[model samples]
Target: MPLCSGYMAPEYAMDGLFSTKSDVFSFGVLVLEIVSGKKNRGFYNSDHELNLLGYAWKLWREGKGTELLDKSMGDVCSVHEVLRCLHVGLLCVQERGEDRPTMTSVVLMLSSESASLPQPKLPGFCMGWNPNETDSSSSKHDESFTVNQVTVTMLNAR
Candidate 1:
């Protein structure tokens, strides 16, 4: 499957390579979105000048991870579990495919409270915006495409 600019992993977006790791990346973004109640795509924080992932990482590093939680949950949610979800999300979004945990590992981490989790590196899309930086979204890939004029992508994992 061709990659969409948003939610596409570096491997797939940069080299047209699609695999389970690519899905892991997308799942990470989804987890972040669910936890923070924000969409990864079109999520721009002006103060930090970062996308959702970068902003979450920023909060995490500053010892303000709890602030990243959705306001509606408030004091009702379990802080430790929420933090673990964030940790797992970051692990799944590491820049390299090899750095990401498999879905099996992810499920285990999410399920077992005693499971030890490795610390996550910064994250992909960390430097989302820079005024003086040269950036372009116009890859050789089209903005979006259709298979037989159908908008949805259909592909099987190896």
Candidate 2:
């Protein structure tokens, strides 16, 4: 979606630079979608590319974020609780990593009703690719190293 929208921010998108905040942003979007039963990437409106995140932000600023709640939830949902979750999600997606809350803080916020929340900054790339293939490459490297070690051990024994 980043590539398609041309909205990929240079810091987080092209450089493969990401931090916990990046995960936070993703988590925010995920939570929003879960609550609203909407998809962020595929959302469409005649006037804007405003995905679920944008739409939620708009509603939030307008004091109508509660309106974005999934109609299906009906009376089961708490308006204040939902708003708090949405606020925390937005804080997670702040454009600058430093501005985002750590997972620890997020958990605290979620669990503690009295916790003070920080104001959220504008969110980073609304969409992008995952560049962390290190886990896959590390496994391949480990296999190669094991093979090399076996070859050396055999030669020494001979």
Say which candidate scores most in lDDT: 1
The digit string of per-residue lDDT tens for model 1 on 6-115 reads 47788887789989999999999999888999887666677637878888888888888888888888898899989999999989888788899999999999999998
In candidate 2, position 79 carries an lDDT of 85
Tell me the whole-model lDDT of each prediction, alpha carbons only.
0.80, 0.68
- What is candidate 1's TM-score against the reference? 0.76
Give TM per candidate: 0.76, 0.70
The sequence of per-residue lDDT tens digits that candidate 2 reaches over residues 85-146 is 88988787666777878888888998998988877766665433332224465666645343
Q: What is the C-alpha RMSD of each candidate to the true structure, in Å?
A: 9.7, 11.0
Error of 2 at 63 (Å): 0.9
Task: Write down the RMSD of candidate 1 (Cα, Å).
Answer: 9.7
